[model samples]
Target: MRRLKAESIFTPKGNSVNEKMYVPRSELETAFIKALRKPKHIIVHGESGCGKTWLYKKILAERKIKYEVLNAATVNTAGSISNAIRALTARLTPFETKSYEERKGATASVGVAKGDLQHTRKYDALPLEPYLELIRILYRNAGANDSFLVIENLEHIVKDEKLVRELSSILMYLDDSEYAKYKIRIILVGTTSNLRDYFSKIDSSQTIINRTQEIPEVSVLLSADAKALVKRGFFDLLKAKCLVDPAKGFDEGYLLNAISWFSANVPQYIHELCLELALEIEANNYIITNELYTQCLRNWVQEALVSENTRMEAHLNSKATKHARRNQVIFTIGLISSNEFSAQEVEDSLRNRFPDSTYGKTLNIPAILNELASGNSPLIRKTPKGTRFRFLDPKIKIMARWILVKDEGKDTITVKKFDESIKF
Candidate 1:
């Protein structure tokens, strides 16, 4: 059997849109493609690591549909967007001679595209019309049908009301009859699922929301997809076999479950974990073992968890009392099966993981949960109902599993033998 390099299969932080190990999500693909077929703009939003950027880039490239990507974080205003495009296309204005023809003539050709070529001295103030028309003229002049302006990392600007409102107006303006023929569209990509809510507080939001097609939240991979990714990476591409059973009866196998469980089935996390595992594999034997998996956890933590571990220490071993048991509770909570969990879930987890628990009997689960969420550096926050809580950051959950601390002495704590914890 032919084999390929691990870098090609596992590209967590690179531009590997057409990786052989990619597991397709048909529903998302259908919705996005349909939006591309129509005149409406597109909004693709989900959790931070849910692959929002990758999803659109992959689809756009596959169909030979051209797209220009701009980060909302950098271009936070309407003027900045216009400026960024000017820089991106290497100043689309004419090279020399009469510049107005290249600017206005190019605009006139593209469905009544408008721009104020007049000098600032000619008007009381420089016209804002040019800011909006630059993109229209640039895309129109490029002459690619079915093109896209993908504005990504919108989370950077979601909190600023003025920026959100500015973006809303821009979206509405693009839906004008003047630009109907170009068939160009906007694909807004962001991490927050409630991106539309940020837009709603502005004026005429209903019209703004209606113009953009909402694809279903790009979410974590399902069980089958998660398993497929691991199998293809380890078995199909690398031709490396594992020492453990594939664990095929249920949703995931032993190897896939271990990788998916800690990564929370996030595509980027899965890629990172598998990539590290691939690097650690012995070339001569080509056999993956439990000890290798353990080593990979340490390797991954070193690479990705410096900040997460520091956050864990902020609330760990709360000095109020040694019997507080806050650290253990946090670790147990990391093993949670869902995003939102109750005090009962933590108690249940403690019972399962450490049935011979002296602490479980006298534990005030809810009280401890409250403590973690209420401090100078709170790690979690309660929902509206106040009965359940979740980590303020999702990465905290993964850190829960592999919390590494050199000191387990009188005043400190950490998870030792994390490889064995998977079995328990």
Candidate 2:
């Protein structure tokens, strides 16, 4: 290479990397489309960087459909529903009001701003029925075939029980309203915890739960898919431009071995791991040999450790809080170490340790487990039940045991070994 271009190498550039990136399985999109075409409601949960949002966007773009997208982060209060309604209504229908007509009629309608005819309380207030009517009128004006409303990151609503209850009730009401009969569908995308936590609080959610389609279980990428991911990122993107050529030749077999150790067969990680490799090559000019990968991984872990330590220090420095976060820190580390505990088991351990603590009080311990599990560090994995908790990397697990021995701590049993020794 003549010279490394940081902009071209580090940041994805040219010809749209999206074309090269692996598309997530279509089962989720198929189900979502089916739900939209029919009366089905939907909830999709995906980990950070899982491309769930991207997939949703693709479906919206490719399908012959009309839809509205709302970022749940923006919905802070009941009043904010106005914006959600406007977005949804605009998608359902486009409007063209004559300025001259509005000017002529402006004096007759006092208090209503000349350009803000839709700002009436009738549409803004709670039952949300009038808003649906506005959507219908706009749909007619726009000549949209139908309307679909997508709410992203619903964890915001789920965090507040009252808000979740209100949203749930609104959805249920809309489902049956004549206004929604053929022209409307609602899709909710949020963390799994948000769904379960809100539903667990209110008995009425059972109806909503039954009506909605669940995200199809994301399976580990087959060996072929994994290889494709690597080939696209390294051979096609990097090697084509001689950006970060591997010494071992960026072969499919090497990529397969590297990703097989990941917790989930998440397709998105392929992009991230490639990014890490690019950064490493730029910083150290290390050829992408197998040994170089090992070194890169070590550096990645150390960086994660330093970041975690900094976060812990910040929490400790924030002394205004009533609760001491030391227990949480210890619990997080222990949970990471004892990778064998189920969500329930982890909660039970925490409860036993601190009877007064209320962090894990909910039956939705699985959600808590998930939050703990997906770390930037590779020191966690999901159990069979899809609960997240800490577990050491294979090498780190061994080192932990050795440290326990050096410190004279009690019982450094390896759960995998212990399980194997038990009789069936």
Candidate 3:
């Protein structure tokens, strides 16, 4: 009997945790819960928009654990971090106890020099012992279940040695405790999957990584999970919204395959595409059709993917190079699932996708790749050593899928409407 609006059940950009729509990443949740219970500092890393923030927030809330999240991007500077810590654990108390007699009468002012009577403000510049205060406050704040300081977006400062060192210094201090048992811990969340490598590049990197425990990368959801989200939201929740049996003029069997393919296994993109499709049902007599889905894809591209599409168009073949098949070759590259690929792999993909097209046989793939990566409004970039390349953004491939289609009749590729690309 559970029910909700499409927008409420599906959120792409919103920060609110939709428990009704949440599909628990079981393995990830289990590992994270284990990490939380352990004594070591924790690091959770994955590609951007892979649900890192929501997962931890959901787990912490369920366990009723006390925690605070500070975005590293906002507190990029070391001084800002120190200021935040200072507010929590550092204080200055007056130590002036010296007795002084006030000039009550002319007798007290008997000094020959009147200037001598004015007593300048004085205090013993006492020792800081900031670490001691930090420990005291941290332990006090660490209630029955202890406390967690989750630093989200750790990737923002990993490149700066000073910030990383300042941060590691605190981590080292936490380990120096002798007798007292303090439960306060730190959890670092980031978008980069290679977080440890980023730290290892720094001098004395072991000092920080040694104190942290990193579970498996929270990469894109498994194909099954992605489909579950679609089924739960599109088929169940949308039905509850009084739009049961919404599929129209389309073979509903393919809906799951369509979403999983177009979403590229990214949960957020899946949510976004599903939300748009659900809206079509609400607006069009509670009936969703292939044409509606197709139009929704274009609307999504125009709204959020304008930049990627523009970049793609900028990297296309010129008018005089029409027969060169640049667009067709790039679409074949988009068919590649791996983010990092070499020119040879791309050429092979070209042959596989377009066996009839002679362009694959003669195209100078490496040179074309270099130009695409280095040209104006570059579509991709090469690694520092130039061994491999990847799309400048993952969204680029998604945009290409929606915008370009291969014309089997002519063995050519052209920008076309979504209906043309729909296999059904």
Candidate 4:
């Protein structure tokens, strides 16, 4: 085995993290493991970058179960679905390795091909029947052993009624077929709510939903778990040797908590923040102080804010001006509020910012807040403690600050200066 590099240990923007730095959440992992024991269709849905794929892949590998992954995002048409199935079927076939002399002899005889040796690659699109047959063959080859088929990013094609109905029909058939006998398990991973929307076009959607085991929404890591992850990445995996003086109010525990808190207990954000800090430390001759960490974190927040603003701008259309303004309301609320704030407080703040003439008189503050809290990429969410709401991620606050500064003027305080003024 090869040694791991410190630089590669923490992947901020990458989808998959190194296994050594993986922090397992017992609740989610246990639920997934239980689902894997039997032949049940599993729907794993969660926010993006919440480690749904990582957890599934890790558990499947640990269990030593044979599995094939198909990306549903690319399977938009019947032919594409058939191609995906064909690829999975190919994985079940065994390949034989020949000795060097035998390989050389075969290569030398390639020019003198017999009638039986002549072969042509098939280009004709396969119909639904052949696709179903291929699925049956795949399950049949599994024999007594159990296998997993993970369909990832299903939300991409969930809106196509034709594709959705066909996929549901196929899954329903394989699930109830006597030939399968529960030997092959199917897992659909997406960001959608339930299979409700995907299977809405099909009549047998009820049966499909009943047969499937839907896992609870994958949530961000707990504060304790997030801290442990930081420790593992910094001390164990990367073996970070940066030392900060105790007089400067920096230590392992404080640093861990700071990272966890600022990241809003999200695993991906934690990695991102830590990765930036690590790079800064390495560049500074392996010395890190509380001030350095804060500076790096502020820089990370500014970069994230710019990226998010750009994304929103790219997504906005000519008619989305009002929508953009409403988003600014949500962003402003997130920026000033601490962890949690009441709806009344948010409304009051909005009114104060955009007085009666502009938005105060007409804006339905509560409705806008509710919509923001409930949307697909929710920036604010209601807390368990009564009617108060808070930003789902700390990074949202930074974005909100960026919006505020941009709206004011170029002469307004920059993100770095603003972050410094605030005592995080």
Candidate 5:
């Protein structure tokens, strides 16, 4: 049998897994594929690391669909949207065939820069006429071709009313104009809860909202899927040279279980943890045991804590009292066995942990919980039980524990291990 390669097994962070390694997401993939076959616009919204972008790219490429990606992260005004549409037109249509002068003239009226067509100047109002004409021309030539325009990082401009209105107009045009006959789907990708939030502030968003076919939020993988992911990366994909000899008493079972537990079925976390373990194995001459995996996990957790602490201190500019109070809540929450906890439970824990502190004496547990659960980058989420809340990602829980341990000056933190019986 051919030996596997390490890189093939472990995908680096922020990179998409290839089709061979791509795990089908069952119902979600089915629904998304079915939607792709129709004419309605698509909104693929989910948690940040839930593989929304990867899944979309993989499916589109595997199906051999023609699509153009417009990153909305840089889009803050109407002109940027126009430029994005123009750029998409240039790629999908025969507009590039026109002479440089003709292309300049074609874009000049739309506020696009003559010297650099890709860079557009801000417009006081959306130049709808040029975009309509361009879309009409493109669709006319498409001739049964299935193409899509994907706007990624759309959450970036959701708060900008002008951009939101312009986007609504664009969607409305696509849905209402003669171009709708071509059945070109406009895919909006983001980490927002729903597309409705993008147009919530706009009065004319009803038309766009009515035209949308939303894909439900992408979620973490099931245990079986996550196990298969790990198994494929380790036993199947890790090169023979990277594995321990049969004589070595490495406990593969324990390591795999630990990975699945630590990752909490999040694909990105799984890849990251597995890659770190693989590097450790390679460096240590393929000698891996339960003890080594535990040590590795501890080190990884500490490293993550340092990084997260620096980020929070720099970016989260809260008053000293509020900052300390939030940190206390986070650390207290970490000590609990379950991810989900009640405001009362958290309050009690805080009081027990820091009895003399102001946070323990007069903290508004409910308010703090709400803020943490609903903030821009939410660390926790309100559960269906009303007052109960759970960490949005398992990694946050892990980091909180690390923070707790370091603050307490502990030599080691004892993490409650996941049940080992669960397998792929």
Candidate 6:
């Protein structure tokens, strides 16, 4: 009799995993290896959840190097930069005997001047000169032959021209500093929007940008990679089955069938979804079937829809007052709803719906275009002519359709009419 196959494996939750179950991007590995050999500043820019952080961590671990990581999402603001610097300084200070003695003296000296070291811990902001001095002192005290400053989510602070200039100066200073002759490195991580915006505004920032290494483009998984992912999931389920019972049930046929239907070679999405289906199958007694896997897919789609709704709600609330034009609203909605149109097509679509609206203005179009392309929208992506937009997320597309049908009753307004309102 053919044995009953157990379901898929458990998907790892909340960004915790060492071994990557997804297809490894060879370009990423190559870039990482080069950076490891020579301490070089790097910028790993990509869409969110495209494995930026994971790739960074993996490469660092594989090389067995000492480094520090500062998550910009947790602390990135005008004042947070000082805190980030201090936090990084604290970590870079090693625990060796010499470092301890050096830090002890530096602490004592500051304490003597300020009355107490504790009072200095809370700061509004550290002046640029003093901040640089502190970094130099810390490096000396720690006896670090080489050091690396890993800054993530730099866009959070890069928006301010002054701040961007200062950051540029700081990186340049450190890169050229006599102490860095031993090969200190700086690694900046952010989405592509961050880099684009930063570069457009700050001339000095180009100095820093030129020195950084970039991760290569990621393509869809190969046939071998897809098979490997399927195999990993199947084997995980088998291990689980052994623990539950010296299983008489659970066979390769059932596992292969499930893989064929739901697996798309998107590792991050596939690994987790497979694991979820596996758990349900185990609970129902190792009888994995296509129907149960289908249920899991349905659940995944629903979850994705809910997440997209939350994003759209936040986006709408923030920009409703700022971007009130009907055409602009339609453009944004189209951006989230479909990824197939060119800029001309979007303009055509808007013109058809609102022919009188001043949809021809370049300035207004670019602003909306920037917002969508900046990774802030998470749903819309820009093509070449700034007129085209694609929905990056499928769930956002579904939500956009719902919104369009619901708002069909409103008086249709065109770009020309919108321009008329602005006329004083």
Per-model root-mean-square deviation over C-alphas: 9.0, 12.0, 6.5, 9.4, 10.7, 12.6
> Against the hidden true structure, what lDDT does model 6 obtain?
0.51
Query: Lowest-lDDT window of 10 residues in candidate 4?
Result: 97-106
Give the poorly placed runs of model 5, Cα more than 4 Å off: 13-17, 76-79, 87-143, 239-250, 283-287, 290-306, 311-364, 371-395, 405-424
lDDT of candidate 2 over 102-149, digit per residue (tens): 122223356654553322222333444545665566466437667666
TM-score per model over all chains: 0.73, 0.56, 0.74, 0.66, 0.68, 0.58
Q: Give lDDT tens digits, candidate 6, residues 198-223.
A: 65467765666666655563323444
* Candidate 6 C-alpha RMSD relative to the actual structure: 12.6
Steric clash count of candidate 5: 0
Name every residue pair that clashes in candidate 2: 92-139, 93-138, 336-390
Model 6 regions lying over 4 Å from their true place: 1-17, 20-22, 90-147, 158-163, 179-182, 193-197, 218-227, 235-266, 310-378, 381-424
The Cα error of candidate 4 at residue 288, in Å, is 2.2
Query: Which is the better candidate, 4 or 6, if ranked by TM-score?
Result: 4
- Model 3, span 1-424: residue lDDT tens: 3446778888986676788777787888999999887778888987666788888888988987877666687665435666555444423223423344444323243545553334444455454454444545555655635777788888777767677776776666646664135566778898655566666666867877777888877767777888888888876767722322454534455667678777776778888888888877776765666677778766665666766766777777663444546786678777777667899898888877677776435878888888888867887777535688877666777767766767656666767543344531
User: Where does model 3 exceed 4 Å of error?
Assistant: 1-3, 14-16, 76-80, 83-139, 178-181, 240-249, 319-329, 338-347, 356-390, 409-411, 416-424
Candidate 1 structure lDDT:
0.70
State residue 132's C-alpha deviation in candidate 6, in Å: 4.8
Ranking by TM-score: 3, 1, 5, 4, 6, 2
Model 4 Cα lDDT, one tens digit per residue, 114-166: 43443344344343463454555556655647876788988776767777876
Superior candidate under lDDT, 4 versus 5: 5
Report the backbone clash tally of model 1: 0
Per-candidate clash tally: 0, 3, 0, 0, 0, 15
| Model 1 lDDT per residue over 1-424, tens place | 5567788888887765745766788999898888788778898987667677778888877897777777776764535655555455445554522222222222233555565343222223333364345556546665746577778887776677767776777788665766655556778888665567667788888888788778888877886788788888888788887775344322226777778777777788888888898887846466787778767866776677566666677777654443436776886787775667899888878656544443337788899899889977777877534678877666777777765332333323445443333432
lDDT of every predicted structure (CA atoms)? 0.70, 0.50, 0.70, 0.65, 0.65, 0.51
